[model samples]
Target: MCGIVTAISTDNVVPVLLEGLRKLEYRGYDSAGLAVLHEDSLVRVRSAGRVAELATMAASRHLTGNIGIAHTRWATHGEPSERNAHPHVSAGLAVVHNGIIENYEAIRERLTAKGFVFESETDTETIAHLVRDKLNAGQPLLEAVRLTANELEGAYAIGVISEADPFTAVVARKGSPLLLGVGERGIYAASDTSALLQVTRKVVYLEDGDVAELKLTGYRIFRPDGSPVERTVTVSSLSADAVELGQYRHYMQKEIFEQPQALGNTLEMIAGGNTISPQVFGAHAGDVLGATRRVLIIACGTSFHAGLVARYWLESIAGIPCAVEIASEYRYRVSVADPETLVVVISQSGETADTLAALKHAKQLGMDKTLAICNVPESAIVRETALRFITRAGPEIGVASTKAFTTQLAALALLTLALAKINDRLTADDENTYLTALRHLPVAVTKVLELEPEIEQWAQRFASKQHALFLGRGRHWPIAMEGALKLKEISYIHAESYAAGELKHGPLALVDRDMPVIAVAPADELLEKLKSNLQEVRARGGELYVFADAGSEIPESDGVHILHMPEHYGMLSPVLHVIPLQLLSYHAALVKGTDVDKPRNLAKSVTVE
Candidate 1:
């Protein structure tokens, strides 16, 4: 997962490309590079590490060009080094690529037999050599891009600039994201809308098998067969302020602290308590309740975990039968759908590849009652679905999502309440209690944030541990899974989560004195069973770290540690319990010297399959 940005203009384009890359750095930041078509040669500058290093190198040398393309890479095919940094150039063409090329070895063999030599270890470099070979054979630049796309066999969003066509840039996509920005001065293209937010709000999202030839004067959209197509440009509603990390040490920290306000805004919109009512779902509640026979929640990564939590809410509180599936797995399964089945897709960016494909598949199966819970209002998920629920988390730049995950939970909780009301499953008192608890969540979350100092101290004790086990029961099982995910994602620690009762079946063997276990043991009926599970871990010599509610008497042990939490209602406890685990992971990663914002082999958005 890499970020790509290209600018074609009448004036020098280096500055615009750099600014765009800054906004898109969250996508990938292992290494950075840029290729500019200057006069009759391709000028390239690259460096390892953050975009700031690349900016310094570019400024030291006057890299002036009217057309240029840039990339910030996350290492996939090779190690993070200057040799593997993108803006991979060949004889006459320079290209920046986003997704993986699965057939690169096959193509490389064919090209090597033709006496073509590769200078870099990236799969993207193969495209540049292939385009150069096509151009040498008298094919036009646009035709060369099309032929390359035909030969390629995986996910990719590529931008190519050639000395033969110094005035134009070609772009094509298969499974990854690509967007075209229409500005008054020139045309800009990038992997996501965040890169183009500063220059223009109007954008056209490129579809699979579509290509665009961008020139200084104008741009044309074409199919893979070179047929002209009329593309609809939608105005982006994302504010310029959304991309900035105002007065914060890092975007990750800012996003973690923004949860209170984000949750409050989402609740206010959904419940119509302090702000304008959200028309996203309330307007369609009656129709959704009347027409739907079952509900399906599709997502991946952190969003999938949120869906897991929502499954409980929808089934238990709303009396609705619900199915939660990972999007990639759900897309290939045999499915039957009708007007009676409602598909709900959860995504932060709303551009996740598998989830988007599943949404399209459901629509193809003739399911018209489809809805999206997303943060980006103008994303493909929102544009394709008939109904949309927008999360109020403004912009989550962290690779490991914090605010967005909580807001999704808050939004889904409200959705469950609405469904229960329309379906006559919930009585007036039940609805009032749930709503009141939700309204108090912002304050509860604030109380959780205050536990950071204690969490940091706990993290110091287990920062050197190589593995951890997380346990929860019932509704808290999803919380356990999410806690393990956050720990592994950022800290690079091997962590596993299990239903507390299932530990004895298999996972108990992994327990030892060296292993540390974190259990989400809130004061509920399940607390007694969870205590027995903790004792089992202790009997096996595994260190125990329990997050318990205040006034709960957890048995003391020499190796066990406890962090008492502020008491809250049962359903809302997960919302508070998740906070300390997040901080624990954050501090552990900080101590381990791992990149908390951009973890290895991970991207903020999974636009490619």
Candidate 2:
């Protein structure tokens, strides 16, 4: 995962480049760099830290140019350092690349035989040298870039700039995301639309094997075989203010609090209706769901956790057999495919590499009933699937996801209700009951937000803990896993989650006063079983912090702490129970002085393998 922004403009673009980098820092912040063609020379600058550091260095060097390319890297091939940063330069050509160059070693050997030397340990440097070699062999700038791209293998999105051709920039995409922004004064290219929203909303999403040339006033697109192609320019629907951290101390905190609004926006379609129709997913959703016999869900990271929760709802409510698989592992393994199974892929960005590949693999195995639940409508996964549900969570700028996860759960609940109705498993009264709960979900989440001050108090004690164990039963088991993930992601604490029934098998061995035990104790069928698991922890002298339903009669004792939720929320209890855990991780990170928005060794979107 990385970010790339390049532009050819009539005026100095240093400010635009830096601002774009700042907006894209969530994609990566390991290192940042830029290269500009100015006064018949290529000028490059780089830093080993955040984009703000690069901005400071650019100001000190007084770097200015009308045509430039900038990058914030995620450090795939080499360690994070100034030498391994992007905008790798060679001769008069400079290149900024995203994704891996799989055959770089052989290409590097061939270039070395030709007496070409490399300066960085990144796969991107080979691209600059190859393009420079092509230009030296009498190929024009555009042809040199296209020829160099043909010689390369593996997924990549690249932007090139040359001193010899100072007014134009060349770009190409194979797998990783890249787009062109048609602006009033310039033509721009970036990995994400968020980077160019300030200047222009008109964007052209590039297809695989497509190359483009950008100039001050116009642009051209070409296929890999040199045939000119046409691509539609779409106006982006995202507002620029959505990415800004307004009044909040960190993007993570803002996203965490935005859950109520996000859920309301996502569930707006079923507001006044007494039942959820299958058509809410898409026009063809009725046909697909009616024929589906089983379900298969594929995802990674936070999306994977959402799918795990859906498995519980799908089997229990819809009376359907469902399987949730980790995308990275599922794609490589040889598994039997059932055509009657509906393949559901969930992603926030819709461009996750492993999940997209897994969807393609399922298609190759003759599973054609594909559906995508995602936030971005134009993302590759949504485009490839037959049916889709677009979540209205807006832009999630934090590396650790908050609003996106909650909105996904809300969407999955709708899907469960729709499938249950189609299978005749849901009664009229049952439909009305579930729909009423969905309508009041936003208000329920608002009530949960009021518990933040209490959660922060718990975080003050949690910050000193080095290890933690989280326990839950039934459907809330995945929520416990998510809570553990958030704690380690931002606060850097060691955390583990287990189903309450599995505690006696193994994880109970690590319990002691030094390790805190957190439990999600909802007032449900498994409440008594979960309470017994808590006693096992108390017997081991483990400190206890439990988020229980208001009706639960659990009281705070010497080593036991209890924070009551506003209500039980019935089937939606998992969604309400997760909010306090999110606040706990956020405040703990705040107390520990860790970067909450951009956590270490993590990116907001996983676009690369």
Residues 84-104 of candidate 1 have per-residue lDDT tens digits of 998888886899998889999
lDDT of each: 0.86, 0.92
TM per candidate comes to 0.90, 0.99
TM-score, cand. 1 vs. native = 0.90
Q: Relative to the unseen true structure, what is the C-alpha lDDT of residue 392 in candidate 1, on a scale of 0 to 100?
A: 85
Q: Per-residue lDDT of 206-275 in model 2, one digit per residue for the tens?
A: 9889999998869999999899999999999888999899899999999988988999999999988897
Quote the positional error of residue 498 for candidate 2 in Å.
0.6
Query: Candidate 2 versus the native: TM-score?
Result: 0.99
